[model samples]
Target chain A: MRHSLTLRIGPATFRIGSAWAQPIDQLARLYADYPDVDGAIADFTVRLQPTSAVRRWVRPSIFITGDHGLADAAPMSLAHGLLAAEMGMNLQMALGWRRHLLLHASSVEKDGRVLVMTGESGSGKSTLAAQLGERGWRLMGDEFALLDLDSGAILPFPRLVSLKNKAIDVIAGEVPAARMGPLLGATAKGDIRHMVPRADAVARMGEGGMPALLLFPRFGSGPAERPVGQGEVFMRLTQASTNYVALGEPGFAALTRFVAQVPARAIDFPSGEAAIAMVDRLWSEIA
Target chain B: MSAALLVMALRDPATTAALDATGWNSLIAMARAERLIGTLAFRLEGLGVPDAVRPILADTRDDAAREARQAIWEADRARAALAPIGLPVILLKGTAYAAAGLPAGRGRFIGDLDILVPRDRIDAAADALVAAGWEWVKEDPYDDAYYRQWMHELPPMIHAERDRMIDVHHTVLPLTARPTPDAAAMMADAVLITDGLYMLCAEDRVCHAAAHLLADGDLQGGLRNLWDIHCLCEESSERQDDFYLCLFEKAAHHQLTAAVWRALRLSHHLFDTEVKAYHVPIEVDYKLRWSDRAFISRLLARNGWGQETRKALVFAFFVRSHWLRMPPLMLARHLLTKWRKGHRPQ
Candidate 1:
């Protein structure tokens, strides 16, 4: 690792070392507002390494590696180094983070209450979370909603909002040009651009709120809503979580608490505006 | 010389509680690299760690518990599946350790369920397993033929509903391997756990672990393999005064004297496992060989950063593993065949 940067992302601190300076430079710029992490022992380490020594200079590709890694993970071109760094950090958290009941969901905080949204790829959850951040909701996170095992509080991660394809334009419209990252063309998940959350999201990252609403949002359809059953919610959440199984009995207990306590709904929307409206309506109805 | 941080921790787990952040970091990384995080987790249980290290340790510990439970459940399912085969179903390796409540099984990660049947009964046993919903994971004809003809086990199979895997082995080593242990005699001496389930006796268990470590594989999970030998020897030696005498006798019978001897010395060197914990001189019994130092260096090839050092040594051992398994001609053919099949033997 010739170049390195360390930053605290909410509950976890990551030390990212890289073969090239580009990824570090991009990450330093994007995560400029993160907490001071000088000489901090990182919770996890991420390294952007070349697949081989000669390969480093040949094609100049990057293998996103860390404390935990997938042996057969494919490499990415240096052009998507920022995306690689993000993936590396996310990979570490997904595989290793255990203090929280981590869910593969986006969340937003309003009035010290949290609304978590989860869906499959292209379900507009990222777009919705990014949209809600500008339209009065404090974006808790756009990738993972960290639920404290003991407290049930939805801890704010709010790293970078990964806006793919059409969602890039949707988020780019609301945020200033400075907040938007460079466009990554033709990735595995199609076109992607990372957007920094609003300053408030970074400033109040330490603050966490009790989860009030859980929504399974689906894009493509015009606005429709259904109350999701608890059993269905539990099963879906288990599938959604990266470390639910790793957390074992405590994870089971925490998830059960979440399913029992939080009000859940499956939402459908054609666009970001409709999803936001549906979220607001559901939040109001929950109380 | 001081052992690697992970080895030191395994030797005395309480010592880690006093380590600074740097020490904990190195220890954790090494443990993870060696796939011994779960074992460390159990050892570090009840000891208070730094707040930062708590979650990491706890996480792996929980996961290890889940793994053990799932492994045991898989073993039970395997037992039920092979019940009607009308042959002895003896558990092997990790499943065996856990089934018999050995220290090696505590916090150990068991992957696929392994069972042994007599070489003659293997076909019937394999057929019964496939009938019992163990679907063929390796559907390729070459792999199937390779396993049936050259290897000791059937092509690896996965349970259709449970998604778990079971590798049914007639013996530990390939047919072409130089050392052909009497699998039938070993099976006859197997200790029964339940009505249908069985595990290897202490001496045979040590021999198998050593064979698997020094003779069978590329030392991929060598640290874990070494740990198994250490614990097995320590526990067995304590239970019986003439444990080493019996062990050596069995090792020679299995044609694994060199492997077992190197295994014992390496375990003693790394883990401080006492062959004379009961006050008998065991080191004096077997003279140290110069080649033992090469393996000692090879075994401790991991640096403080958990990175695997000694690439040449690694490659040499890999070649030796294959060399031990088959003659040069067959080895060349196998490697070429694997290369052509897109599973490059590396």
Candidate 2:
């Protein structure tokens, strides 16, 4: 038995797979009118095989059918969860390709790019993104920002901000009436994700914003936060990008163009609340 | 002829296993072998060989052997071309392997050509190569910025018309570590081959190899380098005094005596290569640790497992030779670059 799942984030579509036979009707009922749900794209395909001396149970073969191409891999019990998470991450990467080109940092738009927060995964990017979104900042992407290579313009891919354990509680408390979803299973990091609804998804789905300010945000336990220099911000953000080297001359030109245009900064906040307030304040100042 | 050669090559279970593991279809293997043969023929000509005997030397019915020869030829041509640009090219692993008289096309396949140039002329050297129709290989924006801003070498370049690749480097490492040795001075003393191209003298070459081995840590690649050092030292032993004196001069010039001492000790222990008398004290343990058998053995097991290990080991010998010919600071700088890139520090 095999099962396939599809998720659409921005313009990208991801197809996933499962090993055992699953009732399509039940799956449809579960995902019916789900906000994150785009549409089903893959037909489930399974291949049976024999066990070999090097292995115990014969791993079933599963295939995902979609626009990218059919991806076939071993269909074990663990494959479903892994595929789902992979699809989510891949969607994020595709949606935010532009930002990925420039800084390779996570970002969210607010008041037409008046505020853009950038940081690596553990640096509280998701928490900050969620808080800003709650305060009326349009969610851009948690993973990658797809930048038009020629123009260096950022295209928006507003999606759910994945919140982990403590952050999930914090968001729920902050927006008590916010629609909360079930706890998704643990990921590689052992933290569970609860898909919270994006506040501006309905209004801003067709809207895109220009990037103005770049920020590198970090959460600290102690008090006393100060602004880092432009040089240091450039150095740190440049190092964080994925294709910084792969883009070659065009990449460099784009980076220089970006840095020159956007004012970069580093912000340190002791708590998520303080961080949200600071971001709001910064947004107000710039707007 | 092709079928017979394939049959003969497949007689070895190792080749069969490699073919299976890599999922190389027969057509792909044949095409790869043909390309390899073509590249080899091109490279041998660059080495000043007449075009007549090149086909004879490069001809291989066996896909793997032909492919290996082709890689060797590309590497040689890449090194040879560096001469026309006024830069001294120290042909590292591939050309060195071929030069050491290994089976013509049966050695390690080179992915890219590694050549060292003086630090001062790095920009000019890169421009020179670029003028010769070598395009800078595209890298991601972050990597592009990092290489331009921090790295010792520009992104690698590939010839537009040929299958040759070259990594043009200035200093061996990044600037953060403050490694010594004036690249400009070394280039001044470089030995000119045909055209305006030059190569580091035997002494500088040996020092470079030593530095590479020490700073690169226990990378599996070091095995090939060690073998190269052993073979090159043996070949140049008759001029041992001259080589040592040149090495001494470089060590003194660059203030890299510690690096030289460490390289010398490791060469002596691992490859049994002798170092001339120099009154510089060095920690033998630290030097030995670079080429320690336990470390090499582990790396070998991890990278060159199965029957292919023998051929890989043979390639490792020649690869080791390139490390000794570099200055210590250059090697340190190279290691730092790799570290900053999030690659395992060699």
Candidate 3:
């Protein structure tokens, strides 16, 4: 608890405490534009500390702990401490948070309507959402899509878009250098760098948008579009949601309403350009 | 003062109305950490909160309510599974409180289902539970053997599809423990709440809570258990004479008179649990006098955050828990084996 930072993202707030100042300093600089929590209390907490007293100086590894933590997760090196802190915050929200139906998805909004994309790793949802933000869409969130359980709206959580491996270079080419955090190399998930969201995204983090479309995107596949049914979407979203079971009936009702209202498609594209084109075509038809 | 605020709020709702957003947040966080959010939420009903803090409390209450509902379903499912096999499942602790509609169960969170059958019927019941799709929680040979041999219960079993666990206890304490409580007598005194479900009678329930708090657990997480005793005592205030007498008889019968006496004294000191005059026997009074002083400091110091300031006291109590359970020789061997296994390479 040496150095700490508080970040208010959309509806939830996180207090991240660190034993070392390096990770805190990096987060403060990267998240400078995000708003502070309205109240003194943060919804979730993340602690990044040395695994032991001696480990503080000797090849320190960041041990993540919070209200809700995995029992036997291994520690991350101090070099990846920032990522550890971020993951810790996400884990707390996914497991402990109850106000919203949390979906492990990325979202971008246009004209008060949001499009959500979810899939497994290497699905290109994060990369596509980042690319779309550069063009005209307002990046709503990358790591989690906060679905209002009662209102059926997508609350904005535009934290820094975490770009890993080739996606870091791809986003770097489009976004200016000043907006990028230090490139974190040799992370567990490959080289990861964070891109500060567009100024508008940070400014409008409190805004909520109605869901217009849901996309299950697959990368490295020949271009094809298939409509997803309500039942399939329900099952897939349940799998994607972290606290759906904990939230029980309320979570089920909210997700059921969302699937009934939103049009879903599984789009497979070989490259980013084709993915964008396919999204555009689907948007036109849906609109 | 922070440590007392949550309990005070639950005892009196007006205390919460004066609290600022920060106070409410800390209280909520502490309640969540202790798994007492539903209890707080239920107690706060009709007592207004600030608009900013209302949503947070509402969300917490919803989650807690969902959990409580699920607990009821689990108990029903457990009955369905075990009833046909003729093992009498006497619901214990949280599930028992909730199922029997006791005051202590309102807005409480039930983790795993605990049921007691006759000691001789333990194996037959375990087989029935397995036949009903509950499998041993631990596949490790040593851990499985440890529970089966030294422990009172089998290794906890989880239903294959539901993932809910059932701790099948034939008795309250481990078999190797110094005090071997007469499980048959306790079962005989059980009151029939319904045809299949039974609960420990009022005095027996109070005694069991005391024993579980002071004798069974390490006392690190006994705050909730102490609260259970407090609520049970308050609920049966009309029968205080019978309750106290029966509590004493059960404690003496189990040879846990000291443990039960300490539980009552602490509950009275901490939560102002009411008891008749001179309830503490003169013999146990000397032991409890210094214990009361030591525990007062440690218990009062614990805030919304966990109790970490009194590490020595916690450790002492932990060692005492083991010492009470097993003789010195067996305890040393058990501790050694545990330490070696823990240090062994994975």
Candidate 4:
């Protein structure tokens, strides 16, 4: 490894090392606002190295290895090294993290209460979260909604909001140019870009809030809203949680408390504007 | 390294209170890498951990406890599957430790279900397992043939519904290996811990663990294996007088005198495993003194030491493991085949 960097995001921290300096340099630049970790003990580690010696110089490909790497995962080309590093960090959190129950959802805070949104990959959760962050809502997290296993509170992660495919251009049109990293093309998921979270989100990453509402959002559909039953919520959240099975009993208790205490709805919207309006209507009704 | 410190603390609870946050972090990471976090959590349950790291430690413990419970359940499932075969199934390694309620199994992670049947009964056992919905994990013809022809265990079988693995072994080591221990003798000495469950006797248990660590396999996770030897030795302190005598006698019978002696020396040196007076006279000078230094460094190094320094040492140990397993002609042929295929058995 030639270069390394460590960043603390909410309760979790990451130590990432790379064979090439370019990825680290870009990461340092993008994550300049986040706090440095306390010490050498990071929650997870990510290593990005060339596939082989000859490949180091000749059309180099970056292979990822770390404490939580999958045994047969394929390597990404050096051009997508940053994406590979990001995926590696996420992989560790998804597989190894145990202190908190992680939801593969986007979250935002309003009036001291957190609203969580989760969906399948192509759903407009990231795009919606990015838009809401610009519109007075404090972005709590993008990839994971960290739920404290003890308190059942949603801790803020607020990492770079990954905007993919059309979402990149959609968010780009709204956000000022400086907040976005360079556009990455042809990723495993398609063209992707990372939007630096709002400064407020980074500044207040330590704050955690009680869960108020859960929304299962579906994009490019006729605008509709339906109530989600408690049983359905529990089953869906178990599917959404990366550490649910590993956390075992504690995870079950926390998730059960969440499903019972919080209200949930399934929302379908044809566009981001319609989604935002529906969310606002829903929030006002709760208020 | 903090890993070594964690092992130390596991032996003594008072040492944990003094560990700083950085130390705790490193210790936790090392424990996770070595698959011993649950073991540490169990050992430290009553001890006072620092406020900052206590929650994480508890979480790790909970996770490991779940895994241990699952392992027990899977063992029960395997027992049911083999019950129809009506043969004495000898549980080996981690499964045996857990089943026999040994200290070494307290927080250990059991990977696969390993059982030993008589050499003549292996085919029947395999047939019973397959009939019970256990399918061969490896689809490759070459790998399947290789295991059936040369290896000690059947091609690992995975229960289609349960998704757990069962490795049915006729003996502890490959048949072609240099040390041809009397399997019949070992099985005859197995103690029946519960209905239909058996474990190797204490002396044979220690010898088999040593042979597995030093002679039969590469030392990728040798530190954890050494810890097992340490616990097993400490457990036998009550019978210290006969422990070493039986250990040596078993070692000699198995042609594993050198392997057992090296294992004991390393365990004693690295972990302060108690060696009784009777065991003190065992030959330690037969192995190169320089090799001792290399093994100590390579085994304890936290990171993968590259090909030049510690990596070379690991490679040498790997080659030696193969050398001990096969005759020269067979070893050469096996190495060439493995090298050409770029595949090493997991």
Q: What do the candidate models score in CA lDDT, each in turn?
A: 0.85, 0.50, 0.80, 0.81
Q: Model 1 chain B, poorest ten-residue lDDT window? A: B277-286
> Candidate 1, what DockQ?
0.47
In candidate 1 the C-alpha lDDT for residue A118 amounts to 92
Worst 10 residues of 3 chain B by lDDT: B300-309
Model 3 pairs whose backbones collide: none
lDDT of 3 by residue, B1-346 (tens): 3446666776677788888755775676556655666778778877777765566667777776676677767777777877887766688889889888888887787899988888778888888888888898797787798898888777999999989999988888888777777778888999877657888888778877877877776665566677788789888866565566667777889777877788788777666777554435533332348757765555444443322335567667778778877778888887888787784211
DockQ, per model, reads 0.47, 0.01, 0.49, 0.41
Lowest lDDT 10-residue stretch of candidate 1 chain A: A36-45
Candidate 1 lDDT over B122-203, as tens digits, reads: 8788788888888888878888898889998888989998888999999878888888887887898999977678999999
Task: Give the Å error, residue A104, model 3.
Answer: 1.3
How is the predicted docking of candidate 3 categorized under the CAPRI scheme? acceptable
Per lDDT, the best of the predicted structures is: 1
Provide the TM-score of chain B versus the true chain B for each model in turn: 0.93, 0.56, 0.89, 0.89
Better of 3 and 4 by DockQ: 3
Any idea what lDDT model 3 has? 0.80
CA shift of A277, model 1, Å: 2.6
Q: For residue A88, give model 1's deviation from the true position in Å.
A: 1.8
- Model 3 residue B289 lDDT score: 81
lDDT score of residue B186 within candidate 3: 82
Native contact fraction per model: 0.25, 0.00, 0.41, 0.38
Model 1 residue B136 lDDT score: 86
